[model samples]
Target: MSGPITLRTQKALVTRYKNSLATAIVQGASVLANEESPKMLAIEATALRETAALVEKALENFTKTADGMEEITEEQDKQIQAYVEEVQAVVANAETLLIRIGAKRTGLQEATPMDEGRRPTVTKKTIVELPEIPIPTFDGKITDSENFWALFDASVHSQDLTGLQKFNYLLKALKGSAREAIKRYPITEANYAAAVELLHSKFGDKDKLIRSLQTRKETASARNSQLTEQRRLLDYLFALVTQLEQNGIVLNGSFVAQKILAKFQPDLQRRLLKQRVVQGNSEELWAVKQLLTDLDTLIKTEEQVSEMLPENEAFRGGTKGRPPPRRYETTSGQRSQMRQNLCIYCSDTEHNSLRCPKVDSARNRREFLKEHKLCINCGKPNHISRECLRSGCTLCDGDKHHFSLCPKRLPTALSSAGPTKSAYTKSSRTTQQPKRADAKQPTSSAKTGAHCINSENK
Candidate 1:
């Protein structure tokens, strides 16, 4: 009922049956050898031997019908049967060997059931899902290397990655000097471990790192920027100290505190030192955290105070709002002395108005008034004597005589220089003594007599 099988078709069938028998033999032996239970191992061996027989029969039928011939001679048939029997014997021997080794049949060896009249379906291979791992990067710096190695080691231990996968991840993370060191090595599982070991050797010098950390000191001055920088340096040192201590180095906390305190300014150092003595607290005595808090507060207070006060001109050797003292040259080529009694009210050089004795005394008041040629009558400054409002003498308060002619006041020689009375009054007044016209009367004697008469009238 079926068309004759072509040579190509027959060959394909033979190859397919041979591959199926090979696969069953390999899988069965693997499972049987690995199985612990004797019963399971026997079961798998029996299934494997049966599958091998079916494969052998299929191969025999194809070989007999080779070259498109429907029938094979007795010799050809016997040969095909002999070959199939030999394969069966080999499968049986393999099963016996597996059983001898105490192999048990496992679920892995369980064969799928086939349809009676349908070809066996080929199953596709299943894809396995792997967990994601974060990669680490390194720049060859000691700090970066420390961080990277820590994370890399953790990742390797946590993830279910093969050696080759780990190597690839390590290579991906390499950069700068680190990348160059391992660049020549082949990308392989063995090389990955070696590269990692090499990196550890190159960058993992604990003593060198400790020495470097010991040398680090805060280089910044005491300021806002310096505070930021100092804090960063101190933090770095602390991290380094922790790392060294973990690696079995015994670092004293007090020693570390002393080292940190050495970085501050001299004034800050003195202050902190004083505080330490006063508090007597041994803990965190020179710790940067506490010192930084104090320093920050100090600097902030200083800034606020500075903002409130004017600049220190004294420090600059000058006074604000005042000019240099004026130097006056005298006629004798000597410097004039500075005026001491500069009056605040009247601006006089002779006396200060505050302590001026003439201010309250009526008799001495006219001295100041006369200096400015002011009227003594009304007490107003800047007016002449003739413009005076008072009709009385300034010295004696007499209404009949002017201040210049008052008898109570002493007369200078200049007061007698001019005649007190007019020549007409002198000539008309009755006198007991008469004088010749040629012999002139002394004007001084006549003026004196006239002053006497005037004083008597007042």
Candidate 2:
């Protein structure tokens, strides 16, 4: 009973595959008979191959399902075998059709010599010639050995060349003591290996190179701890650590890390420590690694921020739209006696504005400033006192003016009331403090005397 039911299901699966294969074989055969073009034949051939694959898969499923069955009558076994043979026959037909289509495609491709009634395509390719790599010359300096060998190896030594050719190349790339070391060996095929080995021992010794790298790191310094200097120091340390690690020397110890750390300023050292410790990395090796990684991030960020700023941004401590007044120098490097601009007070170019002898009195200075439209405080043109960004007058602690132009620095005869105790004045003055602005008025006699002195000064 189970044999009949199991064989029935297997027969149904194989029957579907047999029908699919048969239908595909008919379609392929029709296309092969009607079409002589390779493209059309190829499309039918692909379809036949897919159908054949499906039929084979179904046959596998049928065999697997029958083997798992517990019992099968002799009649059912014959039926299963018949179904398998039917599916196999359809798959065979499909395969034979595919072969015929392939043969047809080959014949058509050979007969036409060109595809789709068009002339054969002549693809033009632009072959770019590359520049030849020049062999690197070495001057026998231990510091330059690594770079020299790296270039020579890539350009000449490791290329497809005979030993004699390589030997000649090595000769051309050597100079000074480097050429001298290999000069004894005659230029021959057999001496190339010996020469290379000798040079490696003298200059490229692993221990010697490692020791050189250590010396470089030990002597490295960034005293100012400026961003550019710090970046340079970081680059050297990064290269040193990489070279050491490549040579199988690890910087797990604090000796090298501490030495490198000592090269930076105290503030930078504290920053490195704080950043590393903040990330919970207390290991010395981790600190060194963190320092390199952090510096890379710091340098990149600084460069990015710098690139985003406008090129015309004014510098601090400088006047906008105009350069600060500067003394001129002669072609012979001697200081010239002339000022950059004519003095507004004395109208002479020989002396600076502040040092003008004729503009001695504060009243005259104020008159000159107003006439020239200069700032009353700093006495510079192009901006008023309120717009001045310069530091205040040191003599009076006044933010509105330069120290030399301060009224308080002038003689007391310039004003009868003396310097007022304004908010702009510094608190450190020991001179007598004048009455507040809101204080009771001075006596009529005192006011009259003040007016008389002011008139005499004018």
List the global CA lDDT of all models. Answer: 0.52, 0.64
Question: How many collisions between residues are there in candidate 2?
Answer: 0
Give one digit per residue, the lDDT tens place, for model 2 in 75-130: 87677656655565566556556656776676566556455665444211112224
The C-alpha stretches of model 2 lying farther than 4 A from their native spots are 1-126, 253-255, 284-287, 307-458
lDDT (tens digit, per residue) of candidate 1 on 279-393: 8867634454565456556545544664566533111111322356668644532423223344322444554323332232233334545554555553334334453333565
The number of residue pairs in model 1 that clash at the backbone is 4
Model 2: lDDT equals 0.64
Candidate 1 Cα outliers beyond 4 Å, as residue runs: 1-134, 217-226, 253-256, 266-271, 281-458
Least lDDT summed over 10 consecutive residues: which range in candidate 2? 120-129
